[model samples]
Target chain A: MTDEPRAWQVVLEAIERDLLDGRLRPGDHLPGERALSADLGVGRSSVREALRVLEVLGLIRTSTGSGPNSGAIIVALPGGGMSALMRLQVAATGFAVEDVVKTRLVLESAVAADLAGASPRPSLAASVSLLDAMESELSAAEFLALDAEFHLTLADASGNQVITATMAGLRSSIESYARLGAASVPSWPDTAARLMREHRGIINAIESGDSASAGAAVHSHIAGYYAETNFPTHRLDDMPA
Target chain B: MTDEPRAWQVVLEAIERDLLDGRLRPGDHLPGERALSADLGVGRSSVREALRVLEVLGLIRTSTGSGPNSGAIIVALPGGGMSALMRLQVAATGFAVEDVVKTRLVLESAVAADLAGASPRPSLAASVSLLDAMESELSAAEFLALDAEFHLTLADASGNQVITATMAGLRSSIESYARLGAASVPSWPDTAARLMREHRGIINAIESGDSASAGAAVHSHIAGYYAETNFPTHRLDDMPA
Candidate 1:
């Protein structure tokens, strides 16, 4: 435990400090690899390795070649990295399906209540637009994808980056299960229709500024679907919302 | 876009599938680097890289040299990876301090309510022990660390792995900010005394099965601490909880 932190970790923490201290912001270019190596007194290879990790974490984008955009640029796309972390963690068996669904219930219900309660409420225009798209004739896969987006859209509208990112990741990590469960529903059309209606019900509750109902609507909307699915080991019945 | 998946990605996905499918339970050792490289038709270096990513993500622990306990072993410890990912993200400016606090409130309050509501209550013994640990004379840092653990122990008692890991990540990410805020707290002893009282209050509420009060207690407990802090920007005043 007393061992010196590795060279790459040193580079990572230095860059992190720079980011935290506002030396790096979105669209800013990092000092070149050679310059970073010299400045930090680490091998160039260590700099490259840290940059790769940063890129994978969606903090920066690295481009190859000698053009003006060749070096790593801070993009700070939090959603993608969070989504990947969640998706991979679920795939690696670290998160159970029941826990994911339960966590989603906690977040989405809060978002619904918050969004509805906001002064001059934030735009649900994106969500409204997506609901329109869901009405179009599409494959089951496409509809489910949009369904996931509608819930995510509400989270996005809340403008809380942590909730939005976590909701997106949780929704997506279970997407494959959603896709699989689609086949088991008695009638895809009926199920899809019911979900679309529930989506509007949630929107109505939020739009009306009924905070409590908005929360309840989101809760029942999620739980109702889980009740209908063949999700194997997890059941939302034990949970009221 | 049609480029073949990278060899390392293929190896990573294969291992993830093995874990998801129950072939790679915790304590199982991954195949040797040479064998995995040959089996997956990727170079040994690519296999090593994928293994390195897995180790960093806390899905496995890698040990050097020849022994039964050596090589990469599946640890599947979710909290460490989630904590590292979240801490890095927060440092990189992907998560606002305000958002982290709000997210923690959402998850922690839900855990409080749920634990109080459970018919056959899960053990609060761990949290009880942590609160006792907090009563000891210690540095502000040590007290705050134990404070963080007390909250985490409640989430753990909830038995929701996702919530537990996410709360651990969120709490640890803001730790430095917490330490920094300690200086402006006016009287450390008074603040620590209040926090200890609130800790007992939360435990008392949960034990008494007052789910609503349990939730409120947690919300106020957190909001009260933040209210005292001279945290540059962000406040809990905007949202009630």
Candidate 2:
């Protein structure tokens, strides 16, 4: 015989089913602990536990005061939840650093090409500004951080939350990889200048509606850095046709 | 003034840094709880808490009785960790249904094309068998179950652990989406037959080493189902080059 689900899991699943069925939605308030416990036939503690996990997962926001916003409100912000999951998984060493970068190459390249080809291209205004900010004198760490933001800005323009979230999740690994390359680099200034140029090249390619060049530019920008850094890249010759 | 770090987070980060530095590797036993607390200057309970989280994330294994094998040992089995994170995120309604499928289309299509172009093609014996099994007499539910597995089988055969995990993580949504389509269709047999044929078309194209056609076939198969089912698909024409 199958084992019964845990009490908190029962509460969690019930809430999830409701959300899936449109019985609950973003911006809706969850029932209070006592009422949920009674309705779901679980203890108040189980309800609380599920709620705490939900809040931590960025599904709901809870405030302590008895004001109108005191209770848990569904916000459905998936990006933060995705980021936390990926961060913890990375910290746990569950993901290999190499796989993280490979995934990024696939997603970010797709995002750039998608941006380049859209009939009415989403504004690269934010991305352009981030690049402008990159030209300022900054530490290797700061420039790489802005570089990470620039890539995320492109993913954001794609308006695909899944790709955006996945890119956001892998942000740290991408930065860490580039930083390792920077560390071994002979001169931070030279590497930074080259990186800024490559970044500008990518933006220019996209803005000119050159999807092939935009995608290839991103692939080369990332793969080129790793190649120079002595990282064993997944053979780029075999990238998606 | 800066607040002190959470005790458990300090322990977690310390372990993570060691993992990043190649100090703690998969299958290496973690220091005993007492030793870890002493080394990190955290309470014993904090050490235990961090270990508990790590175990839950599938990064470690712990057992009781204080035997030689009872200590926590690193296990970098990331699939479960990725799956759990995604499942919880989906449960929280943190990911949109459309974005999830859109991601699947992108990843699975790329995976199929990658498989097509590999010099030493990874075995598709597993995938072939799954497809053969699908042709047998089965209800829509059983056929759909096999269908989901077939997609994952292709992803697994790609040899990219991240794509494999992401596909595995998205399995439920894929199945749920298909089941919805199957339920609403006027004839399950007609749809199933068409789906089976499309599945065969994808495999054949890959086996023939037609990377472009292999990729296009997959994109069409997925986008087609969503189209026939009245799902609002992200435009397939804009798929990655």
Candidate 3:
């Protein structure tokens, strides 16, 4: 007899292989647990375990009760699931703050550049509106929320779901850290003003279709703010200003 | 009373919060399932379910039997779990091949530039060795395996675990598609020769510390090969050369 956990893994991989090869697709319902267990020569419990993991990973949605939709159905990767996974991993692994910051700079700057380079150019309406909203008096938490929305909007404008999902995943951790870092600022008003100006500069660069300028502005905007914090700044100095 | 699935989600989020806030870390043993369920006011099954999801995500390692070492121990993010999740999502959702290819160009180019810019400079010995190994006669599957190793080696050289994990997650899908595309090549030897030349060019650029050349070579190297396949090529034309 197959070992219990290994049996589930085998079932998972079999289903995944079908998905990867295009034999399974979005909107398709997987066979019932009994059917899958019989077909794959595994216990029903093993099949259920595999389906549960798939549901958590956002590869499928599972429903209860007996009906045509009761089994697992393939679906688009949910952004929320991706974000939660990223946040959990970052938290659990304790990735260096510097590495996370640098990674963000690389990803976001590229996003900005891509948005700027799009023909006919993508609209920055959502991002610009967030910047305008930032001009109002707001607490650090409120400001950070808008700041995240602005960046996420820009990521969306790049027209890449993978980049957008990654950005979404990183946003919560970035916000929490930014909140903590805000407590150490010598002058909140000055920092807030500067951040607003930088946000506008990023928006203007994208609006003007200057990919290089947009990329540079995003890089400095991120690196400059992080430099003020106690987090190591030397790692970022190597990046072009 | 909380429903079964919701209860597990609560337990999952509770553990996740601890991990995110630095209370839990790699090598730390989680409380026993019975104790955790009692403390959190849930059934033991919920705790077990949560632990199972965490293990599958590679956030913890669980061993059997009774001892200090028996319960789930927090662990660093495992690349295998991330890769499996990504591959499954890509497969089930049918993420447009064009989008996946463009995302690779953006990420791999940045990885190349970072490797080129590292101080004291990273060695390309491992990557170069793979290129040398590719010169020998090999089947499509064999060559693709080496090809993946070469790219992964470069990703590792970039010194970012996050990027490396993302690249690893994308590798299998990339390999499978490349294998399918290879069947259409008019002459395997000529295509293999051209790919070898491009690999040499990428390695040379990194070795010479030319960030721009390295980035451009990677971008074009990916785009040029994909252009020959039935996959959409127009998506790449908009990307910066």
Candidate 4:
């Protein structure tokens, strides 16, 4: 509980308090860097560094023009903070590919099961469309991207915000790993075809409102992918995509 | 991308850039308040605010004093961040008791299943101890905390850092719900007794290396709890715990 403060840290705190307390809201513009420096007793460089981190998290939008609206404005980017944090951790920790796959299997299966049981049942139409798009995707990179999107869409349709966010973060963290792993498969077409079939089974279960089948389908779909390979590993940062 | 930067957001981005680039590692002290204010061109108040949020997220530790170790230090506190964020989000979202139970079912059951089938197998002894602690806890709050520790331990045993973190986050977020829901039961002792029994069953399954039994036991434990109350609903913020 020491009280010696860092100038930029203090500045960060000031902004966060406003957001939590409602003094700041999305789309609100902040004071200029120079004004803030004068008021907070910190150097201009420290302030710039702080803002850069927030931008990376997608919490604020920065404009460079001389217009009134050209300053930093508060904006809420979906899954931005979560995505950034998980990606950093993934890269930092160097988590294994098997760990990721198993986690995915657990997460997606849960989502699918929940979706199956929801009284009003979410639509899998969007998921079906994504799967359809993936079927025709030409390159491994493109196919992988669409594949990630498809899973994300399915998670989103589950309507559980916490699960949705967690699933998205995990998926995104491994998105690059997944792409590289996909590229390494000796039979890309065969793997893609297998994935497509799995996706179809999952969608079918969800459409039929069969929670058990949906959960089982998603579980097998994910487990099968990892089983086919000995969980081929890749460093997320080293991934080209 | 507009260039008008929000003062605090600017500070955030700057910090992120440093973190991503590995310029600042854990335990590095940031510049003092007045100096950073001067550097970043933000008010002292704003810098303070941003630091608060970062602290809440478990990214940095801030101490105020008259000595060398008295400023903000970049330190890793993933558990703290996950716990705090989950608590806040659960409060804000007003998730149902059933939602929490459902989530636990999915995560814990899946972990059990995965561990059961693991080639070399993993230990479930630590989780068993946690369950025992929960059983012996004198108060509802204490029991709830131990219960969370139990599940987190299980997640770790699954040997997936990603799922471990995710499970920890999910459990922490709904901790209040678990506490409140448990306390809300007609007889706290009876409820605790039932939970202990269920935990024992799951532990036995895990100890015997029966993956299917472990998964089934976990699922039954969670599903049974929810069924007891017919999935009682409550406002997230007003949850008992």
> On a 0 to 1 DockQ scale, where is model 1?
0.40
Using DockQ, rank the candidates from best to worst. 1, 3, 2, 4
Instruction: Write down the worst ten-residue block by lDDT for model 1 chain B.
Output: B232-241
> Candidate 4, which segments miss by more than 4 Å at Cα?
A1-78, A94-98, A113-121, A135-141, A186-194, A208-216, A223-241, B1-55, B59-76, B94-98, B132-137, B226-232, B236-241
lDDT by residue for model 3 over A1-241, one digit each (tens)?
6555577788888997777556677899888889999999998867776777787877788787978877788886746656656666777763455666777888899999988888978778888888889999999888888888888899888877777776776666455677777777898888989999999899889888899999999999998988886654222223232
| Candidate 1: tens digits of C-alpha lDDT, residues A122-160 | 999999999999998887899988888888888888888
Location of the lowest summed lDDT over 10 successive residues in candidate 4 chain A: A232-241
**What tens-digit string does per-residue lDDT give for candidate 4 at A74-174?**
76553665665565554434345566677778878878887888879887888888877776757888887788788888887876655666666677766
User: Higher-TM-score candidate among 2 and 3?
Assistant: 3
Candidate 2: misplaced stretches above 4 Å? A28-52, A61-73, A91-93, A232-241, B6-11, B21-24, B27-57, B60-74, B88-93, B232-241
lDDT tens digits by residue: candidate 3, B27-124: 99999889999989988866776776777777888887988888789876747666766667666664555666777788899999878878888988
* lDDT of the structure predicted as candidate 2: 0.77
Docking class of 3: acceptable
- Best of the candidates, lDDT: 1
Q: What is the TM-score of chain B in candidate 1?
A: 0.93
- The lDDT per prediction is 0.84, 0.77, 0.78, 0.70
Which should have the higher lDDT, number 3 or number 4? 3
TM-score of structure candidate 1? 0.92
Q: What is the TM-score of chain A, computed separately for every candidate?
A: 0.92, 0.87, 0.82, 0.86
Which pairs clash inside model 1? Answer: none
Looking at model 1, give its docking quality level: acceptable
**Best of the two (1, 3) by DockQ:** 1
User: Which window of ten consecutive residues has the lowest lDDT sum in model 3 chain B?
Assistant: B232-241
